[model samples]
Target: MELKTVTAIIGIAWASVITTSAQKITMYSTTPTERWIEKKYSPDKSPVDQADIQVYTDSLLQDVIGFGGTFNELGWDALQCLSAEERDKVMASLFTENGTLFTLGRTPVGASDYAFGYYSYNDVKDDYTMRNFSIDRDRYILIPYIKEALKFRPDLKLWASPWTPPAWMKVNEHYSQKSSGIEGTDIGHNQLDPNRNVLGNVTGFKMQQGYLQAYALYFSKYIQAYRKNGVNIQMIMPQNEIAWTPCWPSCTWRPEDLAIFVTQYLGPQFEKDSIDTEIWVGTVNYPNPDYIRTFLKQKNAEKYVKGVGVQWTGMRALPTVHKEYPSYRYMQTENQCGNAENDWSALENTWKAVVHCFNNGVNSYMYWNMVLNETCKSAWDWAQNTLVIVDRNTRQVRYTDEYYLMKHLSRFVQPGSQMLRASDKENVLAFRNQDGKTVIVIYNPKEQEYSYNIKAGNKNFKVTLQAKSINTLVL
Candidate 1:
């Protein structure tokens, strides 16, 4: 027989043996304008080159807990702009089991950077007893948002972190690191307690002398109070970003401070109170593995910290911690805030961010804001991206590209989904859900459509990827 005839015969045999679209796989995608747009395509059963992307079904990596976003004051304000029916509709989109079914949430312990104003649970000076601790602001704002979310998903889990300790607990007399410079508040000291109409004589600095115990008690009180209010907070991070020092309400803590507190103060205090909440040494934004290493060196450090929560630069330390300590669970505590464009470009960045985090052993991914209004403005004059945007003037809710980005992951990848260690030539991550289905997310960053290949178990298929699109393939 001629060589050409022999080659054609081999190709026909390969096509017959390969898995085709008849195998019944689903393709869901997101474009610049569309969110969770479903498409149908059959896998090519022909002989393909090795250059096509190959996903190995047997190579499982991590078990994903879930995907979610923050419940901040800014997000609350944006949510309130909509009518009650519209509000429920939006909440259902994010929290309901029929929707994204996001089971995890990130909440600020008191006042986060995106808080409406600077305040703490116990701002009163010399209030060591914490008799004045109250979540009145939360009742009016953050609680209502959380309560509404609970209506959609009663199983939502929350982890609380503080941007700073109470004003009297930090270095010198304030919660913020630098001066707001608006009169009484300065780098050296905060002038007075406006709520009490009294000057802040409660002095002496950052978790010093007797302040560590008091501040730890403050966290305990906040957790207890939230529990009393029907909010089941499951975890607590001693600090938001131990390395960050901003003019806003923030505190800069050394590695030892984190170690000493978690191992010595925070951990023991929670135990004494019999609080089931786990302590997390986060939402650590620092990238240095050394800081995490330093904390781990403390006696019984692992006893207190059940997980590591990282965001932004903290990603650098994540894989390292996971590599060294696989026993501890890891999470992307916060997604990087974008420029509030809420466009395809920003969503692409989010795609890369989630991929990177999951590839590095982060089991859960959390976005910064679920919704922000037209301004997308922060309390400190900054703007960041969000999943939904509300137009106050029109009272309209617009889902952004990032919303689809979240949808692509949340819709298909459920809690307890085991990520597959799929080798990627096509910028993809594959995972197997609890139901024994295979899911591969392909992110095409190129300017043109690219044809990719997948090899799962003994079956092989070919996929055509569009330019700059996120495609989820489920088998």
Candidate 2:
């Protein structure tokens, strides 16, 4: 979408009262102590600073796909602790226009580490044709969670990725690649032989033709089954963290092997089955550019691969990969999970990540765990940060600093908004929505409040940012 430039009368007096008919700038600020406080300001007549952050709306970049969080089994399980009304309120806060207005969502195909336990749609051994595939297990947890979100925003776009393929398809024949030594988790939780914990240049999934073909069918059946259940998956990533060997549900695949799976089996099967869901290579956690290049350089990769899903260490490789394949879409698939701190520092880091991705050319950014129990402990014993924390004992919900940080962007930056070019200022982002409103987000990372002069076209305004706070200005 092209951004319409605003032509206005120049030399407007500073400190003039904004008439009702005139455009008024609204500012939303969130600090460590306060959250989402609103204020109003008129155009400043103050002299423009030489260091003013300039937003070029006419010089538009990528169109925003949207912003969202993942839907996990444990998130649903945590909500079960609340009353029906409370649960609905939480859903509304996430999916409703009155709240964050998240337009995108992600779901795991089978199980992520956040699931109550490890499982797959088809656990039947050697079901090469995927005849035994079923999504019945999701009916109890994931389906209901997603249905509630759809209740608020039926048009929410969703995508899916699996933490691991079915255990039967992997060479180790285990759901978890290795056992996490955390208390209460050990060899019993994971059956993979200790000696088989090889990492680099390994293909966890069996490289046989039957297993490859069946895995492809497994993906097809998953899409069809979810569609039958009222949830439409718009895209699919072949794997999550293709190079990581975490103790949770995970699979490692050499880039070349994955490229072959996409070109020979998964891509062809999707075509024969008439599945319109896009195929993306992703949830990549590796930082090596060569790792991604190996897959993209494969013959016919451009034909099937729609985009790249990057996160964690993979963010380091985004600039090089994006520059090389400028036409392919890119997304920040997962936000880095902190060590369950959920403090101001963590929120600041997350803000930096959001700014980095949007600045680097990602169309969309996704948060990891949207809501978790107060303990914030995963089934694999990993504690991670979340936007909201539900206290099982008290049935209380606490919105974290990160939640407001997301709201500072997602609440105002509508889907299809064009990312506006902004000066290379640290902790600043600008976007022009389809409605022609420009939203500017800035972060004050210091202990002292900072003042910024924002120049957007003929309009020049000054905003006072609170200490250690996030601010969004909507014009």
Candidate 3:
């Protein structure tokens, strides 16, 4: 994780200080609250690493103070989707114990479009019969990757979701990769469609009244399988992007249908199976407050759902939703391809995605496909748009500016740490925590350099933000 560094002369009143991206420290005070820059007192300083700077102060230097929750939804599918050799390089760059890349990831239950090819955990006989199911797919690679990740953060929280169920479970008679012959007919557990060769061999499962119960059983099997392999899942999104009928590995459900399935069947099934994982609904692409309203408005919605997961255009509408459902926690589940021209438009769009969601009460933000090829190829034909891209030709993985920008929050702002409010300062985004610790992450996505004042506690610091650059200051 080598960063670009330059010796720059920065001033604080009559004092001049040398700063670099590698090592930096800036101080400001309208009225010096107190100064303690030691290895132990500074919240930013590392306790495990013996040689890092520490800083501390006591008292609210300013009155404009606020805090919110923080978490991440990073990607791990690319690792599973790529060839073993290619996946290794991606892991080396991002999944290390001290890696600067990302910690959290999103994984599929079955063969997602991003995977090397189509497959599932239990590919044994009677996949949908719920009679003789098994998880053989994980032992070779998936579980190993998870074990390596646990070495970094033993308590790492994982949020699991599926793009598509097994070929035996869909009403269309096959998983996403295959074409649907019959439009609206239910594929029963005993039904085997020989014509759907797209998925190799798909014996479509029955969509009987007990389908929800069967789904619950499937989920239980998945949890048990992963647990046996020593991975504890924290949460699960009912389905990914349930609004759109995707080109590959997709499922669609109306808001009312989702509410009913979750509240009546899935929720109760989880309780019965003793699976403590939290159930999040509406992994919708955009923030459709109407959809959220539909779910939350369900007679006893609060009892069944943990929170709402949204992405894309939906994130833009969070402020309005936050005001209406302040009680419900919202999360930016997934997003990608934000004009990767390495410009402010890209930076500003990413910033807006983060701060807007946080300001409007979103506790977590995760990007799509954490690491991609140098050319950024995908089964869906998606291109290079990851925070980190692994170049196959050179066999070298490169980090993007977005990686550093996300670190401004993901790395510094620990889980359970609340986000505090300061001011947006037009382009500069500001947030603080309950402990009065503040992280003002700013980016000059434009061509011209800009300056802003961040007044916190009794301090007013002038920030000179360079164009197409990112800055994060803690006070």
Give TM per candidate. Answer: 0.88, 0.94, 0.73
What are the per-residue Cα lDDT tens digits for candidate 3 across 378-415? 45444435666655556555666555556555544555
Candidate 2 lDDT by residue in tens digits, 102-162: 9889999899989988899999999998888889989888998999999999999999999
Question: Which prediction has more favorable lDDT, 2 or 3?
Answer: 2
Task: Give the clashing pairs for model 2.
Answer: 14-45
lDDT of each: 0.78, 0.88, 0.56
Supply every candidate's count of residue pairs whose N, Cα or C atoms clash at under 3 angstroms: 2, 1, 21
TM-score of 3: 0.73
lDDT of 2 at 122: 92
lDDT of 1 at 229: 86
Give the C-alpha miss distance for residue 288 in model 3, angstroms. Answer: 2.9
lDDT of 1 by residue, 392-434 (tens): 9999888888887787788778887998877773377888987
Q: Where does the lowest 10-residue lDDT sum fall in candidate 2?
A: 2-11
Best by lDDT: 2
